[model samples]
Target: MEPTDDFYSAYDDPTGAPTSMTTMSCAIENAKHMHTLLASLLLGRKKDQLVRCDIDASGLYFTAHSKGKSLQIKTSMVSDLFETFQYFEAEATSFRICVNHILDGLGVFGTSAMASTAVTCSYSAQEGVFSMVLTDDGVLAECSIKTMVDDEHNDCSLGVFERSFEGAKVLGHMILASNALHDACSEFHELPTGAAVELVLHPTSFASSSDDAMCFRMQAHTPTSSCEMELHKDSTAIVQVQVEATIAASFQWTLLQAGLQVLPVASESFLRLNAQGFCSIQHMLLLGSHRAFVDVLLCPDAA
Candidate 1:
């Protein structure tokens, strides 16, 4: 969408003031795209706390942390997610800002405005105030949110993918549609909040049984699904499970439930298991013209 006159116009400050200072800024042409994406990442988050923001020439990254779980959401704003993205900093800059404030400034819906909101985000390089400007139907509202130093970094790495999982025994590997995995998680809601979702990997079929006794089996090769497994003592070679592998692993049903949030954006997902009973779930999502990936690592319960 083309930028409107109000959207492109620049303002020195919210109040009628004149200033010569220019700030580091970027504009998300379609605020709805950002609003929906943020909502998905921030779902189930209770506290409206500070989230780390990293802005660079590559893209914008937001990291949310609570309890012991940390989620890192990344997307390219220059070309992929944002219609127009610009960062003035030569090196990457990090700051702390409240997620609730950004969401509130977006105002995706429930507003009386007739036009979609255009958002402009700026940070004062000197004063360090993060500001958001929203324009809708010729009306503009600007907010300056205080920023804080981000001295902490969350080490949220995948943890030695090739060494750990490669040498470990491959219990089960299944590829299913995003909706299929979502339905599997939804069915477990009736049993218990923390009940484990059991996955039985067979030679030719993959069966998912919830704590509520709801069980369903999927073939290894179906028109719409695919399942594969390895039963050898030590082998990473993936082959269709044609015999009973007797491999069973359980994962926290709540984690699967949380993963369902990606269904609306994901197309297909692959589920894998390791000898240590670690399960990795990967989702392929299409974000506008770009393809994005989301992976969840779930630790299995003791047998």
Candidate 2:
């Protein structure tokens, strides 16, 4: 009897008393029972330092405290628990039959009262590693003897798949995080109100390291003056502006980098108009590592 035929035949009439039908039904029931037991064990009973269990459509998520820091565990693919078990077994540990339910269920050939099967598995944490034993019987199954180090951040120690925060920094095939971008822009102040400015950014160099210093040449344009700026990795930035003062006029300008407007360079320097009717004042500003050079542009007027 083929496995498919046996399954259909068992479903059609479970009481047929055929040996193949009986075995097929037994295996299906065993798998179902195993799933039920795992669900119950994961969702039930309070254990040491285990505070919260949150089950979502994705999988099981839980938080526990170990050594004054919070640790999180996420278990996915639980609906196909047997397949998941097999997957883990293939990678790390093999299932051991401490007791066989099938042999014990036959009774005459068995010696164990519990009719349980257990497998030992090990996992790692930052400070240390731990082991666990998962047992299953025809009636019930539970993960027991789980020992882990009391560390605050256990997620850092899990394997790639078991990680609670996997691929969190991945954005559009890039490893850059939003916070990194935000931090880079935070050095600039807001754009001045109603000031028309044109920004030009030039990438001076690229390096192998993600954190390498990038050199940029920026040009900011205003109605009466244009400023050129140079930014480097050392957080040092400089701006040189040539202004054409018609009547000792005062206008506000802002420096923008990575979409962030930084503090405006306040200038009270007098502009001595040249024969071209424009005066140029050269200035330099230094910024820290959390900033990047994107472009030089004028901003809205400060009305």
Best by lDDT: 1
Q: What local lDDT score does residue 231 receive in model 2, on the 0 to 100 scale?
A: 35
* Tens digit of per-residue lDDT, candidate 2, span 114-143: 234332222332212222233344222222
For model 2, give the RMSD to the true fold: 25.1
Q: Write the per-residue lDDT of candidate 1 for residues 26-113, one digit (tens) a residue.
A: 6765676566555544535554566667778777676543335422333234335665666666788877666666666677333443
Q: How close is every model to the real structure, measured as TM-score?
A: 0.64, 0.18
Model 1 TM-score on a 0 to 1 scale: 0.64
Scanning candidate 2 in windows of ten residues, the lowest lDDT window is 1-10
Clashes within 3 Å, all models in order: 4, 21
Query: Quick one: best TM-score, which candidate?
Result: 1
lDDT: worst 10-residue window of model 1: 1-10
